[model samples]
Target: MNKIKAYGTESHKDDLKEMTIERRDVLENDVKIDILYCGVCHSDIHAAKNDWGNSKYPLVPGHEIVGKVVEVGSAVKDYKEGDIVGVGCMVDSCQECQPCENDLEQFCEKGMVGTYNGKNKHTGKQTFGGYSTTVTVREEFVLKVPTNLDTKAVAPLLCAGITTYSPLNHWNVKKGDKVGVVGLGGLGHMGIKFAHAMGAETIMITTSPDKAKDAKRLGADDVIISKNEDEMKKHKNSFDFILNTVPVKHDINPYLNLLKIDATMCMVGAIEPLEPMNGGNLIMGRKRVAGSLIGGIKETQEMLDFCGEHNITSDIEMIDMQDINTAFERVTDSDVKYRFVIDMDSLK
Candidate 1:
């Protein structure tokens, strides 16, 4: 065991602060990473505060991690010391499961292990995340980072980027498709970039008209104010695909009406039950509503490769590790332009 410095909330009632965590020693198939940058995710805050009622105490909350390889176990292949790499939402999954065999480890039948707040199969200890100084993970869960992109900005790509890219890639969204990205936050911005890069006519669907200019600047070809009846009706049944990124509950009926016959609307946000939909909307058009989780490891690597080819990275604000509490508050208030990434050097 290796004891390392980290920042974490001791309990739901406490603020994140300096602490010590134990990382497993490098096994034959493991690679050790010296943490550099870690993106602050909304779920990180939720887990720390026990918002979902499943948070473990003394939780180190960060999964969007990017760092450099400092050590590789003897059996580790495809990576070496000093290589830029990343560790996303999953650290381990049952490799023998059907999903793992299909390269869909995110849906492992035995339940994939989260990067943090999960029970580690090796030690039976609660897994800690990237707010720490170092992390040792299996080679399979470590991703190859694109050295061409801004290293700091690439942190969010591990989570937000993969979450959006997976669905677009899965549905085969491509040239000549009209893609509507609902919401304008972290996930929505990436949705716009991916859809645009894939040659889709990307539209930003939002309730706020003020978001239009920034939406366009983020690669959205057009903006649709969901509140405007005239504007909503203008694009009725014309969209080939819609990627809904709204994390909150709202009437989805309006978005459903915008899809063409047999077209699909995928929800990447709002993991909870949505506002009741009018059955007639789907019944008449044969429209489909689907949801997707973060991509599997193979797909995440593909997303990274795609971003490398297109020069895609999240627009993020850098924050010191000490300011994580403040960053968490800002995220909950939706006060950030896109995402927040911690400069782990400050923690050191």
Candidate 2:
């Protein structure tokens, strides 16, 4: 075992602090990464604090990882030392499952091993995440980072970027599509950028009119203040597609009623059990509400390639490791611009 410097909470109530964790030596098909920047995902806060009810203690929660390949096992064929790479929410899954065979490992039947607070399939040990200085993952689970993108900004691409991109790609969003992105935070910001780059007429729907200018700056051709009945009425039955990224529960019917006939809305947020929906909305307009998790390994790589082609990345506020607690509080209060990224060098 190799000891590496990291910052993590030893208990659910404890704040993150300097610590050392053990990383297994490189095995066949394993690549060791020297983590550079780790994006602070909202889910990370949940996991770190055990809010989800399943979180394990001594957790190091981060998945939006961008790093350099510092070592590769002998069996590793494509990657070499010093290559830029990334790891998302997943680290491993049962490859023989139908979902894995179909390159949708995110839905692996046997349970995909999450980057943090998940049991390693092989050893039944807990897996830590990118809050650490280094990680060793299977080569197949690792993704190639785009050579030209801003390495720091690109960190969120692994999680936030792919989370939004997969739905847009799956729905075949094309030029002239009227796309609605709900919310204007980390995930929503990426949705707006991706929809705009896909040549769609991007509209950002938010409760606050204050986000209007910021939405336009992030590539929304138009911004609708959803709280205003008149503004909401104007876009009724208009959107061809909607990406809902709000984590809190709200009246989804307004957004549902605003979808054009046969239009589909995909959700990348709201993990809690939602209240019953009115079937009338769906049956009347034939609108569909679907949900998507982060992309599988193959689709995630494709998303990265697409982002590279379009020069898309999250707008992030960089912070030191020590500020993670404050950042979590800010995130809960919705006080951030878009996303937060932790400079791994700060941990050292």
> Who wins the lDDT comparison?
1
Error of 1 at 207 (Å): 0.8
User: What C-alpha lDDT, on a 0 to 100 scale, does residue 310 get in candidate 2?
Assistant: 91
TM-scores across all candidates?
0.99, 0.98
lDDT, candidate 1, 1-348, per-residue tens: 999999998899999999999999999999999999999988898899998999988899999999999999999989999999999999999999899999999899999999999888889999999998999999999999988999999999999999999999999999999999999998999999999999999999999999999999989999999999999999999999999999988889999999999999999889888999999999988999999999999999999999999999999999999999899899999899899999999999
Task: Output the lDDT of residue 134, model 1.
Answer: 95
Q: What is the C-alpha lDDT of each candidate?
A: 0.94, 0.91
Off by over 4 Å in 1: none
Q: lDDT tens string, model 2, 304-339?
A: 998889998889999999898899999999899888
Error of 1 at 45 (Å): 1.1
Backbone clash numbers for all candidates listed: 0, 0
Give the residue spans of candidate 2 off by over 4 A.
none
lDDT of 1 at 97: 86
Worst 10 residues of 1 by lDDT: 42-51
